[model samples]
Target: MQRLLVALLAAFDAAIAAAVGLVVLLAPLTLLWTLAFGITADWGALWPLTGTLWEFGHGVPLAVTIPDELLVALAIPAQAASFAVSITPLAFLLFTLLFAARSGARAAAAGTWLLGVLSGTVVFTAISTAVALTARLDAAQTPLLLAIVLPAAVYFVGALCGAVRVAWEEGDGGILDRLHDRLDVHEDWAPVPAAVVRGAAFALVGVVGTAALALAVMTLFRGGEVVALFQASRVDALGATVMTLAQLVYLPTLIVWAASWLAGPGFAVGVGTAVSPAGTQLGVVPGVPVFGLLPENSSMWMLIVVLVPIAAGAFAGWAVRSRLVWEGTPLGTAQRAVIAVGIAVVTAGVGGIAAVLANGSMGPGRLSEVGPAALPFMLALGLEVLVGAAILLLSPRHRDELAEERTDRWIAEMSELEPSQAPVVPVPGIPLPRAHDQAFDDTAPLDDVRGFRPPTGNRD
Candidate 1:
């Protein structure tokens, strides 16, 4: 009965998560549409449009076709009237992913993680499919496969992450615990792998932190331009507010692009454009406020920005070195090098993925291709980081460090030894002379060598 109750609760929580994301994105738009168009607004079409926007948020590519008559009447070029809308602001998807993760975690904590994750995922999937089937816009039709697959994929990943977290924190006689125990059993092989992960994490954080700082500084100098573009858009307060919110969600994405720029591959505003510290080769760009931060053909000295990734890598390597000092493991220099290199390689892979996601079309023509080239970005970042890691990893250790490690190992071994192995103290053997017997003799008999003796004040 309790298990059944948990399953039902998981499903209910999953449904609530989907509803929350939908309602949050939908409700405001619905209210704004009513205010803007009043009773004359096609309420039916509005709901469907809201649904379409919701679908787009989950990464479903959208094709928008403007009517031929409307394009011709507006005197717009035929080519500009219809364009693919594949780029998405990921805030809603992030919300849904986090919410689903929470639901999965709650379910896991309740007793059965497997049932919780599976049930929640299934419920979310069904709701997503229903939403997909019901919400179709006349102007925009999403790919049917994307409509079902994308949401399901997000929910499943969230649930898996949640389940893993739960299993790690509180085992359920599960596979995670088993794996953990196995790893623990092989203690000799664990430290380097663990250190590698920690170092990679530190490196990634450094890159992001540096990018954020750069963004803040760039914003300060370019605030006026951003404001000018925002004003030029002429969007109303509500519309502007929505746009601002969407941009905030993509802030992380931009940070990655900035990191790429610092790494030297730079990012694109359109085809044949490159905005790197090395040079600015942009032809045309959209009037989005964020694009205002792009550098205008600056100086050759800016190419020095490529040093940031190398610095980040160095910091990561230094961090690993510090950790290893206390780790007291007998890891070889070669092993350290391998681990550091692996961390850099993984960090590079992350850079590649970020470049791909952060670089995509915001509009047609020159605007279609944006962000950094993944391959170049990844290679440059990885190589730069490896240089830093190698500096620390391949360096010779000081003799003091080796001596300290030896001392620590000795202490550890001492703690493990049995008390029976310790040396014993012998009892005194001489039942020697009484005071009277000693007084009778001019010289006292010599005490046995093994016996305790009193100190004499005289010296020869």
Candidate 2:
């Protein structure tokens, strides 16, 4: 009964997530459609447009084709008339992942994480299937199979991660518990997996934070350039609003590019352009307002930005080490080494995935290659992080750290003892009271000191 309830609730959560994403797309689109073409406009195209965009936002690439009449009227080059828009907005996908994660956490709390994740994924996939089947656009077409699978995959992965994270800390009384027990048998390696995961999470957070800070600094310094581009576009209020919203949605994509820059590989704005801290090499580039953030020139000294990821890795290692000490589960040098490597590997994997999502065609011609190359970014970040983590994790244990661990262990042991079972400590020339002696009640009134007498007991 409990499992069934959890599954049902999870399915409900999945439906809400999908519905909310659709509504978000539909609402603004509805207003825009009405304002642009009035009630006489083809309302049938709205749902298809919304659905196609939703699919695109989930990382599905669209094969965009300009209508023959529009192309001829606009005098667009034949080569530029059709192109693939693979760079996803990522906002919708992010929303779904976060909602699914929340639902999975709830399910883990309910003690049915696996069932909840499976049920939620099944429902999400069904919704995706319906959307794929119904949403057909003559201008923008997405792969049917990809449209059905990608969103569901995103939800599934997010839910599994969230559920496992919670269950790992608070036993799920099933598979996780058994796995934990098995890991426990090997004391040295017991904390390795959890520590690695924790450290990797910390590293990713640090990288993202640094990337965001860099983006903010760029915005502050380059605000005028962005504004200039926006003004040069000469867009009306609605177009401007739409442009702003689009930029906002692509913020995460920009952050990923910034991270790649910090990692030293940088990213490409077009086929032959390179925007890196080391140097900025380019020819003609798109005039998107966000592109204004790109540095026109770079100095060799700017390569020092690569240190950012290293610092993040070092911070992760310190955090993991502190946690291990706090928990009285100090690992051996080999175990720490494995943890450091694991942190690097995990960080690299995440970086690679982000690069894959962020690096895709933005338009026809030179715009075909945009964002960072996944392999370079991953290898660079992994190596840099490994160096930093190794510096912390592979180093000899400090005396202070060992002393703190011992102190914590002692305190925990003492805390577990009953009052009567607590051992007494004696000071030189000061006898300790015996445990069997009558205990004084703090609530009772104190008697006069003049009439007070010592109990008859050992004085030594």
Candidate 3:
């Protein structure tokens, strides 16, 4: 049963991945074709062509629109040609092979999924763009063209890339070794189960957090009491101080929590659970008593109040533990804190300034009319600067836990150490480059490096 389930899941994943790869390759072709040929194509003619193309090429009769036909025509042919040349079975195969070579089974699975998603997005965009662009084109030609061209193009490109990737990896010893080295460390951890659980849990938390935040913010805005308070403020130094303090406290709290939510379960889950609204009746969390103190109309206020503490708690927890609940690798305390605070402050300041400028009255309708939109832009820039400054001042340390894993694998491979033993000394023949040398060099051609052979002499 377990084997069957795993096989089914793998098949599903592969299908999705292939679909995505086809789309990615197709989008650019569609875009280029639309630009070159113009949007005024005959849809009636295009539809039949598209249907024929899918039937003959991909062996699937997918329904597509006229504008989509135009795009498909452009993308499909090139993809088909490449696939023919390479003789690869599926588009996602390249990504899978690359991952397998570089980081073993786990990495291969992740890379395959990532590539598949990217491909799918590309295809969706291509079809959508084509439809929008050629809306006014001749209806008959549009459909015929799409039906004939799109599927063939996408499939061919996918196959071509997959074949090329596999061939390249198989031929290159250094590249293959590097991939194996990268994947070696996490052999003990079962990736599929962990990934499935984490993905589902985080998704659930995200939906709940988003709904809660939206409800709270909408409620606060409708109440109108806060607006009145802002309007009634006196123009004295004391008033300014009080106003600033209120803004500082309230805005930061709201912003931080909002940021946490954006960061998802990794950062927000702990915070969300920790925060309690004052009093009874409407707690942020079930069975908690924090919602009672909020004014009847102050939903926004309640949300902010609840989120601020949650953000703070989550940040503190993450800082100390070095790992977010869902993450495999650990981060330093300082890094966690900086990320939390930076995101929160920047979001709140920009959002607040934009709101004020948009709604605030400023003398005779002249500056008020044109200046409101500009305020948000200016605020966004200012917030960016503030966040950058905070990052500089805090000096957060990024712990390269993933890199360490890779290094350990490299060391183990070199030393011929057993999986259970501590990593032995570096092997003699492997040439380990210095950190600076390993940094990416854009000017260097990867193809040339592939043909070069390293010395076989043992350094030790």
lDDT of 1 by residue, 336-427 (tens): 88877888998998888667656666666676787778899999999988888888777888798889898998888867865544333433
RMSD of each: 7.4, 4.7, 24.9
- What lDDT is reached at residue 259 by model 2? 98
Give the candidate number with the greatest lDDT: 2
Top candidate, metric TM-score: 2
Candidate 3 lDDT, tens digit per residue, 1-460?
A: 6434433444444345444544543454354445545687533444333323222223222232334565477664432221111111121333433322332232123334224333433443354334434332232222345433444344334433443344334432445446555645645322322222222233223323553574477446544554444445534544454454434323323332333322221111111122222212222321111212133322223434434323433433333233332244333444444444444344444334423322221112121121112343334323432333334324444456456656766865857853334333443443444445443421344345545675688888
Each candidate: what lDDT? Answer: 0.79, 0.92, 0.35
Of the pair 1 and 2, which is ahead by TM-score? 2
Superposition error at 421 for model 3 (Å): 15
- The digit string of per-residue lDDT tens for model 2 on 308-386 reads 9999999999999988887888888899999999999999999999999999999999999999999999999999999
Question: What ranges in model 2 sit over 4 Å off?
Answer: 408-460
> What's the lDDT for residue 197 in model 2?
98
Preferred candidate (TM-score higher): 2 or 3: 2
